[model samples]
Target: MTHDPIPARLAALKTTSTPDLKSQWRDLFDTEAPPFNRRYLESRLAYRIQELVYGGLKPETVRRLERLGEELDGGDKRKRGIRADRDRPITGTRLLREWQGVEQIVTVTRDGFEWQGRPYKSLSAIARAITGTRWNGWVFFGLKNHRGRA
Candidate 1:
């Protein structure tokens, strides 16, 4: 049997007071390229309405959405405010220069060398062994005396 056209079925569905009809419409749009393109175009019209109704999102929320989009599109996954170059020891020196805390020191036992007042055998070993998500400030700063002299 031939199926009823989507526009007619959608019109019929609209007469009902079901909240889920929006989602059903979305699903139908996903299945049909023409409907999908139409809905995509129509959604742009609602952008201003959404902004007006929601009173616009906060700056932080907008940033989060941008970041999420980047991640979804296989772009950068790094968090904002985190400098990409700062992940390396050489670049992290700036952070070390700014902070005056002994806690910045991370001890390395393999190389038997002190880094930022903590001991470490080699940078590679430190990189390999310290598998945490946090930034390492010690390696970049180099060893400093208790007086804070590098």
Candidate 2:
């Protein structure tokens, strides 16, 4: 029968020093040893050890977590809608807005949005920088609207 190894891993995590933790991390994760704090290593290694022994979360559990995340982030990002919107927009199709008496403009790029000749990660980042607060980029630029909340 398969036995649970969680208890043993937990015990080792509590006793291991920083250098020992690095070695364990390499053995477990098979990645380059990181230079992290002892507490950080302990917590991460503890999590990984349990993840290995007990296996990962269920698919339903992951979906529930994703939904909770979307709700918390105030986005109901439908995959179909996102794909359709992305495919429809051509590069250089200018998105324009006026905020606080200043005209704001952004150009759609093959990879991402561009503003003032600078490549931006998201339009929301530009919106936040322009407004000095969190404003949904899609709503700010009239690309999308809050359809009765998430």
Q: What is the lDDT of every predicted structure here? A: 0.45, 0.81
lDDT of 1 by residue, 1-150 (tens): 976354454455435433344454445345322333344434432443345445678999999998887876567556454454332344233222223343433443332434555555555344344444343334434544445344
Which residue pairs overlap in candidate 1's backbone? 108-119, 108-120, 111-121, 115-118
Q: Per-residue lDDT of 23-93 in model 2, one digit per residue for the tens?
A: 98899899966776688888888888888877889899999988886876566666425534433357889
Badly placed stretches (over 4 Å) of model 2 are 1-5, 76-150
Q: What TM-score would every model get versus the actual structure?
A: 0.22, 0.43
Q: Compare the candidates by TM-score and give the number of the best one.
A: 2
* Candidate 1 ranges beyond 4 A from true positions: 1-36, 71-150
